[model samples]
Target: MARGEPVTVEPVVGEPAAVADLGGERALLVADVHAGIEVGLRYERGVELDSRADARRERLCDLIRETDADRLVVLGDLAHRIGAPDGDEREELAALIRAVTDRVPMTLVEGNHDAGVAEAFADELDVIGADGGVLDGTVAACHGHTWPAPALLDADVVCTGHEHPQVRLEDAVGGSRVERAWLRGDLDPAAFTEAGTEADLPDDPPELVVFPAFNERSGGTWVNVEGQSFLAPYLPAALPAADAYLLDGTRLGEYRRV
Candidate 1:
């Protein structure tokens, strides 16, 4: 957790979630909870799911407790829709935020699915731009739909969640299963220079950490295949030699989306 040294990143105990312990500031980070996802499925995908709002809240609370984190940083897509949230989404998000904030402070990094989220939780939590936030001068975190702030790219490590990175593995029996996973690699320092982002570039580029979707019910892109797309504009180049890991910290080795 020293400056310019790799920060220790790991999944929360007994959860498909992760947290970064940045010496002075500890953060429990999760992404794409997508509250009211059941509603989105009901309308768009023709599937109905019983409201699991309480269950989602409980799961997050449990992770917070397990990690003993001082703060919770949701990477984005806290709600399901792209525009305004519906009554169901609002209620669900409000309940979850209230429950978590009641125990510890929370910070939300805006994402593509978070257009109206700032207003929804304006009074309860701190909302930051999608570009990202710097943590304790060591870690920079963002939602990863676009380019991160230059200052963030210069941090010791940069964490993102918009990819909801996952991997598909096939067994000898001709069966396959998908598991939520983490992607870690170094960013290409030239990307910042080429993009003209105004910041002091590090001698060695910071590492990039892509988180998995916190909600298991959500979908993810297979990251080990050819031409697989990602939401982050600087990715695939920013992280040319990324390695994939399961939520339990199982190393799946190097992967390429293209």
Candidate 2:
């Protein structure tokens, strides 16, 4: 509940989720919901997908109720499509939103995948733009896929859900496993210089926090690897060095980079 400390909750295996305790009021923070992920996979990539949307929603709702959080902060990628929400997806998303909003304040931080869909649910939710906005106690939430705005950098603590950071842990069989993780580190000031956005760099890099993607289909952009540009800025040795927190339900631990 204190600064730099997150009370962790472990969800079932294969269920991607996490919660952050913010003092008296807890924050049910989830990322990359990608509401219509199955539809996108099917229509765009020709992959037959099955998403347990109902079950997942119910589980998430149960968690929220259990935590007694004052609000739910969806980090980003609430919707999968860029333009419109399909029939089934729209209904499911609406139902899910309604179910949560009925109980507590639900805020959405727009992600790249959440363009027009926000307007569709504007009446039912408080949707923040890419620039994001501040909440209680220096807490700023945003979808971390894009460059952060100057204002966000000035917040006491910045939280985002882009990059879907994951760490590779090998099983006994030597097979690799990837679990959704949170990257907690200071903002890299050098990233701006590298991207030629030095003029935009903040006087000081704020404490950086990256939430894991809530959508199961969305893994992570492997940092520490070459030719993978999506998460280059968040990588260590970059301006604002970041650390990784691998989340498996209530169990949260430091992710050792290999």
Candidate 3:
């Protein structure tokens, strides 16, 4: 019911979502909404396509209802545009934010793509700074485009998105497929301490959970594929022994080996 309280997280069985207990508030955790990506594709790649904003909003609203979440905690990337929103992106965000907040209060831990987003939608939702948001004092959530704030290192668990992790699985006949995945591991203190972070390292570091992108359109790093690399600066080093799991709850052991 308050900060410094206990918290727990459980990934939804087959969806890129989690039901988190931030003390007394139940929250549905998702990341990388990337609204109006259609506009981005059309302009950048000349790949015209219809917008899926309606479906995206409905899917998110349904998740909130299904999970009975009191709040919607988006780890980051609520907007697709790299800078200030305009045109279709603004329209899309307005509708999405209104729909979600109408169902449940929302928190936006601003992601890299969310430049000027908070200033644009300041009144519609709660905006946490780029350093990340601390919930229940025991859990931290950040968009993993940068090092987590020094203060977040103290939580029992730190949840992040922006890696948008995916894995390439090969079958016996040389067939292959890519699937979104969840990555988790114990935090490695060296990544921060050695990097000259300001916070004192915890004696035993907390768990680090890298969530998959909620937007399937946002292609991700092929973690198990050769030549692919992680986007986060502290990844692999910070989570040297991270394990990967498919959205269906299939554990594939070590991510690099999977």
lDDT of each: 0.81, 0.67, 0.88
What digit string (tens of lDDT, one per residue) describes model 1 on residues 1-258?
Answer: 225556776767446577787667677988889898898888888998898888999999988887888899888888887878868888888899999999899988999999988986789988889888887677778887877777786578777887877788889999988778888888886663336656666667788888899888888878886667876787767887988888776788897531
- CA lDDT for candidate 2: 0.67
Off by over 4 Å in 1: 1-5, 192-199
lDDT (tens digit, per residue) of candidate 3 on 1-258: 123433467899899999888878999999899998998888888988878999999999999999999999999999997989999999999999999988889999999999988999999889888778688778889898877788787788889999999999989999989999999888886683336656677876778889999999989998988888889888778888999999999999999999
Q: Which model, 1 or 2, shows the larger lDDT?
A: 1
TM-score of each: 0.92, 0.80, 0.95
| All candidates in order of TM-score, best leading | 3, 1, 2
lDDT of 2 by residue, 124-230 (tens): 88888886776654677777656655566545567777778766666789998766666666666555233555355555556666666777677677654445556
Model 1 residue 48 CA deviation in Å: 1.4
Which numbered prediction scores highest in TM-score against the true structure? 3
Error (Å) of candidate 1 at residue 216 is 1.2
Give the count of colliding residue pairs in each prediction. Answer: 1, 12, 0
TM-score of model 1 relative to the true fold?
0.92
Which sections of candidate 3 miss by over 4 Å? 1-7
Query: Could you tell me how far off, in angstroms, the CA of residue 46 lies in candidate 1 after the best superposition?
Result: 3.0
RMSD of each: 2.4, 4.2, 2.6
